[model samples]
Target: MRVGKASDTDVEQVGTMREGKLDQKHLLFGEDDSPNNYDLNMGLTGGGGWRTPRHRHNFDQIRYVIQGELPYTETEVLKEGWVGYFPESVHYGPQERAEGLRTMVLQCGGASGQGYLSVARREAVNAELNKVGEFKKGLYHYTDANGVAQTKDGSEAIFEHATGGALRFAAPRYTDVIAMDPDAYDWHKSQDTGVEEKWLGRFTERDLRIGFLRLDAGAVYQAGQFNSIEILFQTKGRVTAGGTEYGPETGYEFLANEGPVQVEAVEPTEFLRMVLHTF
Candidate 1:
């Protein structure tokens, strides 16, 4: 098992930080197949300051709040530990005020050799119903071993049938992002599970496989026939991946180019895992 750690200074690309106003910590940027298009950044804003004017983009956007509160025009105001998903070809502009605004932003898909916003347009008073509709649809669902829908409302929250987490780099098109509560599970120490095991769920979409994983202390786990790149984010405790040892609040990534590697839990651990398979 290997792991990697991303430091505060390691992320310095400020996509839109105003002087003495706001700052962005890009955790994972320029990864996977969609190099020019993919971006995951954290934003922090100062008090008594205004955020960048509302704008639109050709690509999709997802914002997860790690702390504090921020408001969106169409969606409701989000506080700490909330996630907001914006679909491709939609408009999302925020007018927020806070002691400081902090958020994690993820972007996927590319078009016409353009980066981020294709054109710089003026900020507008967004229409109540911003866009006609969104390009993509809902999250993928699964039927449990009992043949009943594991997720009653949707797959965004807990999914009993989910085996392993899915990744956008693996199944770019079918990948749908979700915001979840970290304290949703009753986590136990690794020694509890006799054998080290992880279940990456079935493909929600043909090319997409997403789920969660838990490992016992010193338990080694691996996958066969992965045929796609996988991304894992440390959600609970600590673990090692890709020749690195990472603890909580760290992200580790691996390409299936070689073969499946050992994934072991140093302590008890959980991860937000996603594998994107080529069709």
Candidate 2:
């Protein structure tokens, strides 16, 4: 089991691949050797906020709004406390996020086996690309081999630059992005006493899952006993595990069936749980 706290993580400005300003607190990073390596982070839109063109990725993402709403499209909005699932190769935004909007995001490899890119690698390429071209707004402006002026999506440009090849996207499996409201779902009792769950749904053959877990004060719950990587993010209250006390904003990780670790709730605690995609 791996545990980390948001307070221990430093807040950093977002990469220049996207438009505007945002700051993030990265909570957890998955095994780098694995194809499904991922990053879990929480970010807040700064002064001018942020925007993204109508774009898609080769990876999957799960986003939860903590404060303010997410303008997913020109017409659709995900209000505070809502969640969204962005499937690989699926397009959604042309978004214009308002200032002070805070969101928790998980980005990982999708079912298509196209491994996600690491931030470290991407940022390295960003610096290299900076010497050749300029990133303005959400686009990269450059002069290609033919000496012709070109403009491309900043993220796509970074990927191609890093790999020295054209960026490719998988054939989309899901027709559209999924938006969910957790409050509309009812919490059901889990097998463990004093523990309950509100499962949103599972996705793809990989069995990726999104859910909420609640543990009443003084209760001990066994966590991380799953066939795939399981992550639990403490959203409210406090808990103690392996003799360590963890408060809100703490994140825990367990490898496939690596645990049934004991976690005791010091206060009535709630957690956002994710079962990552299995290869």
State candidate 2's TM-score.
0.97
Tell me the tens digit of each residue's lDDT in model 1 across 1-279: 223344643544332222135565545544333423355555666656544334343344555566776666535465675555554334344454475666655554432222332111111101111232111112223455677653221111111112123211121332233334434534443333433323323432334444456776887656333565555556667666656677765654455554456767888876655554343
The CA lDDT at 262 in model 2 is 93
lDDT of 2 by residue, 78-99 (tens): 8998889999999988899999
Q: lDDT for every model?
A: 0.45, 0.89
Please give the lDDT score at residue 196 for candidate 1. Answer: 33
Ten residues in sequence with the least summed lDDT for candidate 2: 28-37
Evaluated at residue 219, the lDDT of candidate 1 is 74
